[model samples]
Target chain A: LAKTTQPISMDSYEGQEVNITCSHNNIATNDYITWYQQFPSQGPRFIIQGYKTKVTNEVASLFIPADRKSSTLSLPRVSLSDTAVYYCLVGWRGGGNKLTFGTGTQLKVEL
Target chain B: EAGVAQSPRYKIIEKRQSVAFWCNPISGHATLYWYQQILGQGPKLLIQFQNNGVVDDSQLPKDRFSAERLKGVDSTLKIQPAKLEDSAVYLCASVPGQNTEAFFGQGTRLTVV
Candidate 1:
């Protein structure tokens, strides 16, 4: 399992974009980067995943640099409801998929 | 499709007592995971099972905590002689396959007094 480091917390206002970066210096070649969102009293929800380059979905976008040592999660036009803890995980796709999580970045979206 | 299901959304027990939690994963999900999340902290993986077989349990406290998935369907996690530190939310998550997204239940909050 690879370790990840992220900002402890971030503040954003409505209609602003939020980008949270994660660092995994020991990321393996077979590992994929994934982002999850967790609201209070709820389990984490998958937001986006990518192996390299950029991947976008209805919820968010994932940007992975060529080095694969770091990734960024981009949320556009945030709202107060978007306030949650964001986790970045790195793990293999198939066998022994042990995804490890860090303290996570708490994004506080305000009006 | 339904998401993961867990029972007894809340539980309170005295120290040295026993408690158990049940979980039902989404239909056709092969991988199931149990995690313990403390307040103000990220969830910690306790165990992982793939189709009724243990995949990883290195982080599980074998002496006081045990979990099993019989017939590869419903699962149960038990804690014996629980301590105050055992008070935390037990979360169950499952995925259809190795590469797919995982679905999580609301989780069982355990409070040990």
Candidate 2:
């Protein structure tokens, strides 16, 4: 498993876009960058996943640089309801089949 | 259409007591996982099962914790002689396969005194 480092917390206002970046200096070639959003008292929800370049979904976008050493999760038009903890996971597609979640970045969306 | 299910949302027990938690994965999901999350920390994988076979349990305290997934469907995690450090939320998750996303239950919160 590749260890990831991300901000502890970030603050954003309504209608603004929020971007959270994660650094994985020792990422493996077979590893994928995945992001999950977790609300209070709820399970973490899959936001987006990418192996490289960019991938977008109905909820968010993932941007991975050419080196694949880091990735960013971009959320469009933030709202108060978007306040949650964001997790960046770097793991191989298969193998252990375990998710190693770190102390996620807490995003606070204010009005 | 239903998601993963867990029973006994909360449990309070004294040290040296025994407690068990149950989990039912989503229909047709072959992979199940159990994780422990302490306050202000991310979930740590305790065990992983592919169908009825164990995949990984290196992090589990085998001396006191045991888990079984019989018939490759419902699973149970039991802890005997629980300690105060065992207080945390236990989350159960299931994924269809290595290529699919995982879904987690609300989790069982355990408090040991």
Tens digits of per-residue lDDT, candidate 2, B50-91, equal 999999999999999999999999999999989999999999
User: Can you tell me the CAPRI class of model 1?
Assistant: medium
What's the C-alpha lDDT at position B59 in model 1? 95
Q: Compare the candidates by DockQ and give the number of the best one.
A: 1
Which runs of model 1 end up more than 4 angstroms from their true locations? none
Q: Model 1 TM-score? A: 0.98
Q: Which pairs clash in the backbone of model 2?
A: none
Best by lDDT: 1
Q: What CAPRI-style quality would you assign to candidate 2?
A: medium
Could you list the CA RMSD of all candidates, in the order they appear?
1.0, 1.2
Distance from true location, Cα of A87 in model 1, Å: 0.2
> Per-prediction TM-score, chain A only?
0.96, 0.96
What's the C-alpha lDDT at position A98 in model 2?
A: 67
Model 2 chain B scores worst on lDDT over the 10 consecutive residues at B95-104
